[model samples]
Target: MAPFLTRLSGRAGFRLAAVSVTAMLALSSCGGSTSRSAPVLPDGADPHAPEVTEISALTFRAPIAAGIIQTSRGGADEEFGLNVTPQWIESSATAVSQIVAGDVQAAQSSYFGVIDAARQGIDVIIVSESYASNPGAASLESMPDSGITELKDLIGKKVAVVSLNSSHAVKIKDSLLDQGLDPAQVEFVELPYGQVPAALQQGTVDASSAQGATLAQVKDTLDTVTIFDYGDGKYNGMAESGWIMKKTFIEQNPNTVAAFQCALLKGTEQVKDEAVYAEILKTDLGFDDQAVASDIAPEFGATIRSEPLQLNADILKKIGSIDEDFDVASITLPTPDNCG
Candidate 1:
């Protein structure tokens, strides 16, 4: 695969590449095993059959990561004749760079980031849906002392987000338009998830957007008031993120893609059990607070529906994040019959 130009500014690409390499080395040193037993195949299956494919994937600690984690931990990939190793990534935007550079074969990617990459003429395809937004899944909030109790209060203030034109940012902007407030008047500061709570406490940003573990962190650590929930109104049930592979990779490895989708589909179903989901949060994701784990509501699925995808594309264009029209269907790979 040819390396595509990264949109990351300055030496961010190099930094992310270094991180990816380091993660690979670290995972390899441990024999690249999660220590989970592979599922028992049906009668007459060869126990010593070789794995058909091996893939490196990019993931971070989030609701979406749960599915990937389960795929590895529950031995779904092994059952499907695949060896999948997930590398931890710091920035979602850099996933494209890693995939194009051949550092990773797949990534749990943001819906908005995928759309943005396609608009830049990058060839990427959504292999499966990772997570969708449910009520209270994501929100914009402010510290108690910030006096920002409503959406209108954010008009001329700074808001912190993980990405500038991310789905989080777009939802907040769309909400502002609903309130008759100019979203442009609100400055968006991009900060790492770990730094967002500190930034809000220090008054660096008047409000901040958060989801998944980060949302739990802010609520547990601070007495923040919600300005609005992103998963409300028209944004409810929107496509939040998905698993993506380069279009060329999909064309070259159709069976591998199908195997991945099949494995991930089982993983998605595994996480639906409350006990299993909570255990993953505490063990895999390092969530110390039991309450936080129980409080989080994740909507995991493997099917890439067209309606939610199209809604996100329309929002991106309405918010001026993309100039040209995009058909979400064009960027999606039909689920192979074997995936079921």
Candidate 2:
């Protein structure tokens, strides 16, 4: 298993990315045509601690990212007089790497990202599960024009995964194995999420699977057939990514992470209300389509479940993607005091 994301190091990447994320959110929220200036980084004590007066979050502009954004609703942090300033990163790899470099204390990425980073000797932990994935949330789709009508068509063909050793790759391999196909037989190429649709159209990739914005963006595209979506039945209950932090962050600022988790869980529960659901959909989640937003809203309670974790670990072990001794219990990072 090779690393699939940008292995960013140092503070320079953090500075530029921090500013970029703020602007990126402003643009996305403003429909990309209009400009909205980001607020300046708030004055603070420890920039890394959410318990501080101001804290920064690093994220990609995707659905899992929305889980953290939901915590900002109703000014949860503001109610405590804490300001959360979000910074943007290009991919999950960057998001987690920046956390390791101490650029930001908290961020979210696929669970395997923590394992991958741990192999590199970077201590990290899952503070909470951020995204409880739906079965069809991510997929590998092929062009009907390319004669890739079945899962077996992917044998000896190129498949697109945004990164290797990523949850997308894990799911694709899981789907292939379930179909009784040998995953090693398929060639998986790294294609940016935005490019996979075009690659399918051009016949460069036999299939591609995507989640979050990419899935929503291309859900209606024609002439493509789904080859491997995280579901189609085999993988029904899997937790996708965690709201992660460097273990050092959790250790040094236990109360900070505790406060963060409490507010997050509270926010998580709040959105479940129908009235709050609609408001979050339009505001923090940024769904232009009311129906679609409601369809994709996250269930916070789902994150605390143990079944999906054991299921996820078992699948990865069978694929040789995770260590044979990988333990689901160990992967459940400790929660802060007073956190449910």
Candidate 3:
């Protein structure tokens, strides 16, 4: 019973219950074992002391827009009193691995990474949010000769995505389940994001599901079929991407975490403001005049329930095909009191 990412009432109980589980798991693990303890500041050391080194944050794309906030507003050194470096990864999978290895302090990851990480006991938390759905970015591009018009039309057709764990795959799965189609009836292939358009062109796959600037670029040439505009109606409540960090890091550096929140929330507010968005495009994002004029990014707001982010757990559970006995009510995390 998968619901579209649309508005659905009566889900608060489910979310709260899930949060309880997350909170328990997060807190209980603190006492279980410790191979390496969290870094501790020396006695008499100032907590607000300025940092001389950079903190590493992994990103999956070019360092622009929100990515700039990590470096320009205040590099890791200024924000964490420690230099914060932004490392770009080609895929979210690499970012997860880096975080697990303690190579990076934070990352902007796909929601799928969060779920997979939790399932693997990585002790991660969603600290902030970024983009959701952009109608222009969710194009369901198809081959010109595929004769595909709507999502339902591709009921049994082969669909291609970068990977089953990728956000594109989640969007494709959620979309198929929402349309009352048997997801297994359709075939899926693991094609890279850049090659999706070409795969569609060659009829290697019936369609390619991709989001963000990539979709915008290939929509016209691929004769993209508009399946569901996640942002068009109220379905935009879906969580497409957000900020995530290790639980141990958040506890050991509460102030740093707060500062991180302030900076990101500030960035969100700035991005929401039309004037600021313009400035970001012209200066921060470094987009050309023509591209900036056409691209419309999603607006952000400061709703920081970092510990327990507002997610569609029921929807996720359904799409993930989690068993009823999986007990989401016994498995979600809690929000911090300081989070707004």
Please report the candidate that would top lDDT against the real structure.
Answer: 1
Global lDDT scores for all candidate models? 0.72, 0.59, 0.53
Candidate 3 per-residue lDDT, tens place, 150-224, comes to 777777888776545656666566777877877777787665555666777677888776554455555645546
lDDT for model 1 comes to: 0.72
Question: Number of the top candidate by TM-score?
Answer: 1
* lDDT tens digits, residue span 225-304, model 2: 76665644655556776677766676666556666666566556655666666554455545677335525444344245
- Against the true structure, candidate 3 has what lDDT? 0.53
Model 3 residue 326 CA deviation in Å: 7.6
Tens-digit lDDT string for candidate 1 (1-340): 1111122432364367446544544444333112222111233223224234887778765665788888877888888887777766656576766775566789877788777666555566788888888788778879998889998888789988777656788888877887777899989877766677888888888998877677877887897898988877887788888888876676666667778878888878888887877777777666777545536666888776889988888887777777656777777775545443
Candidate 2 lDDT for residue 209:
72
User: Which pairs clash (backbone N, Cα, C closer than 3 Å) in model 2?
Assistant: 21-88, 139-209, 140-208
Which runs of model 3 end up more than 4 angstroms from their true locations?
Answer: 1-53, 62-82, 220-223, 275-287, 305-310, 324-340
lDDT of 2 at 78: 55
Higher-scoring candidate on lDDT, 1 or 2 = 1
Instruction: Candidate 1: list runs displaced more than 4 Å.
Output: 1-52, 291-294
TM-score of each: 0.83, 0.75, 0.70
Error of 2 at 136 (Å): 3.5
Name the runs in model 2 displaced over 4 angstroms.
1-51, 273-303, 336-340
